[model samples]
Target: MTEQGGTCAIPGDHHDTAACEHISRMLARISDKWTLLVVRTLGNGPRRFNALRREVGEISQKMLASTLRDLEENGFVSRTVTPVTPPQVEYALTPLGKEFLCPVRGLAEWVVANAERIDAARASYAERRAGE
Candidate 1:
């Protein structure tokens, strides 16, 4: 009964923005530059906070903390604290986050596979610009 491509269950109705906020948040959480790197690093195994900082070079402490908190809230990662001396804390991916690995890894592999061509395209554009 609905018009073509209308999202609402009722006829001729539009999609509700508020209804989609959760998905919006989910997409935003994992799509940021630092988020992808952090998740990918955690996919390997649990690592101490310092190790994460080292692996993600150039990232500020505040950014790392915020990113981890978001991922933890979204159920993509787990944070554990140990009671031993110095009180250690570490992070690792949840199974949900682990599920994101193969597809993202494929994307990285595709970039590697096409890097030469992409570089050549950029170089060609630069040359053309310089010639003008």
Candidate 2:
């Protein structure tokens, strides 16, 4: 990498600043609750539309469809449609999506592992607030 005007450019590349910003925005997008849940559900295996909705729970049809579209656009999920008397659609993780599952699962496991500590902290904060 080379530094130019306080911005580091990767070898043979341009727009490092823009790339960083874009990646940050993408991270925020996928780190959202709906996205994470959708990705996690898909991690288990391919799922049809209605099945995905039921598994994710409480996500409106519109929201789930939107989330799946976003994930598909991002190349994190693959959508396949089979034709017959009626069309059948299934959603599964792409290679990229499967790669993302590792970190998401790790983060989820960490949250579960720390839930008690987090609750304790929240309770302590609430007590302090009550005193105030």
Candidate 3:
């Protein structure tokens, strides 16, 4: 119930408005612009902070740091600081995080595969909204 997209005990044992609200917030965090990309990239392997920044496309430093910290807090990532050198640091997916990689990648693939149709749907919705 913490942050995973699962049922909630709030209100009742059965699905409730509180569960829906929890789901919405969880999606907001996981599907965040940087979080999604960061998880995808980290799925490949552990990476240094700068390496992650470069690989995740266009993410600001502060946003990336915050997202990584969030991911770490959510048990999706592990952060380690090497004692050697000028204090090297790296991040990798925990077992739990790895469990979600396939699903996230599949969602991304679905978007790519249906981009045209999805875009058309969005444009139609926008046009309908404008006319309303």
Candidate 4:
């Protein structure tokens, strides 16, 4: 990567600074912990707000709401409301969201597969640091 003006440009890509910034912002949003968990949960199928909240586990209602709003605004998730009685609200992943899941699942699998190795590495690093 090379710095052009104030933005970093990829070695071969032609995106401008503004486009790069937008991509960075989007990657940050989708890579957030809450967003990842929510997307993974929704990948199972559409879910009611309460069901989704329950399945995601440990995420506060407020945080889930904010995450959902952000995902919907960015076109990764869709929200549907049925106007009956108290009304039913559901959230589901868009096609883009589903496509995004491929890499997310791959990362999750890699981490799971290497968790023991990672733990050993962390322990080794800590031992070296303590000796210093």
lDDT of each: 0.81, 0.90, 0.88, 0.89
Poorest stretch of ten by lDDT in candidate 1: 1-10
**Per-model TM against the reference:** 0.75, 0.85, 0.78, 0.87
lDDT of 3 by residue, 5-83 (tens): 5555564455465767767778788887788899999999999999999999889999999999999998999999999
The TM-score measured for candidate 3 stands at 0.78
Please provide the root mean square deviation of candidate 2 (C-alpha atoms, Å).
4.7
Q: Give per-residue CA lDDT, model 1, range 31-59, as digits (tens).
A: 88888888888877898988999998889
Which pairs in model 4 have colliding backbones?
Answer: none
Residue pairs of candidate 3 with colliding backbone atoms: none
The residue-by-residue lDDT of candidate 2 on 1-132, one tens digit each, is 333554333655655877655666788789999999999999999999999999999999999999999999999999999996689999999999999999999999999999999999999999999999
Candidate 3 off by > 4 Å = 1-22, 125-132
Better of 3 and 4 by lDDT: 4
**Best model per lDDT:** 2
Q: Candidate 2: list runs displaced more than 4 Å.
A: 1-16
Extract clashing residue pairs from model 1.
Answer: none
The best candidate by TM-score is: 4
Q: Please give, for residues 1-132, the per-residue lDDT of candidate 4 as tens digits.
A: 444455444655655676777777888899999999999999899999999999999999999999999999989899999999999999999999999888889888998999999999999999999999
C-alpha lDDT of residue 78 in model 2? 96
